[model samples]
Target: MLDLLLAAEEGAHAEPTAFFLEPYQWVSVAMVVLIAVFIWKKVPGMITGGLDSKIAAIRAQLDEAKALRAEAEALRNEYQAKIAGAEQDAQAMMDNARREADAILVKAEADSSAMVERRKKMAEDKIAAAEREAIADVRATAVMAATKASRKLIAEKHDAGADKALADEVIAGL
Candidate 1:
């Protein structure tokens, strides 16, 4: 066992073998070959190109979103303007209605006043006609009474002697 231990120690201190025949040297060579293959294939440039294309697509999407937002804002403003115009039109219509109502009211008032005046004039004319008729009736009654009184007086005072005198005078004149 002592001799076996001495032989193992001697092997451990021995000089290195040929570079290609060592296991660690073979692993180093494989890594170098793989790195060289990757460089030759331009893998880094392809990766950068792919990343740049993705960035451009994202930027284009962002720009489209901004344009859509601007279009929406413009539409909102247009709708607001239309609403304002509609409100103004409604107010104008209301004003016109009020003016028309006032005009109608004035016309109705005038018509009513005219009707009242016409009725008053008609009443006055009727009253005047009635007064004239009453006056004429009173004058006729007064004339009848005076004629009757004068006839009664003449009948009571006239005598046969005066009648004879009146008769003689009338005959002489004739």
Candidate 2:
């Protein structure tokens, strides 16, 4: 120690020292002591454990988000199916309405045609009846005329004596 002091006195350019150690060497010794103390306290294990816990929490959150996304997608697919079914039902209803309308039109046409046929039949029957009535009237008028002409001819051709002879012949036959 005395020698080191003498050396320091002899040169102003001597390296500075304290307690037989240089300043740089003391700094190195302090760093080694700090590292040893950290190991003894298990600070490295605590830091790694904290990091591991944080990683596990993040993984759990990711899994939950994935589940939620899958559920949302399923709901979307279900809604899409429902919409498609609704569209199909609407189309079916429209088709049914069109078919019913067509049926109604056909029925109406058939009914109208039947009505026209009935009317035609009734008109023909009326015309036939009128013709028969006119023929009957003409025959009656001809019979009346023929009877008058026959009476005139009989009066002109036969006298009172011929009528008395005809009457006497009818009485004898009876």
Give the per-residue lDDT of model 2 (tens digit) for 51-85: 99999999999999999999999999999999999
Clashing pairs in 1: none
Tens digits of per-residue lDDT, candidate 1, 61-165, equal: 999999999999999999999999999999999999999999999999989989999999999999999999999999999999999999999889888988999
Give the lDDT of residue 137 in candidate 1: 94
**Model 2 Cα RMSD, 1 decimal:** 34.5
Task: Extract clashing residue pairs from model 2.
Answer: none
The C-alpha stretches of model 1 lying farther than 4 A from their native spots are 1-27, 89-174
Worst 10 residues of 1 by lDDT: 12-21
Candidate 2 error regions (>4 Å): 1-11, 89-174
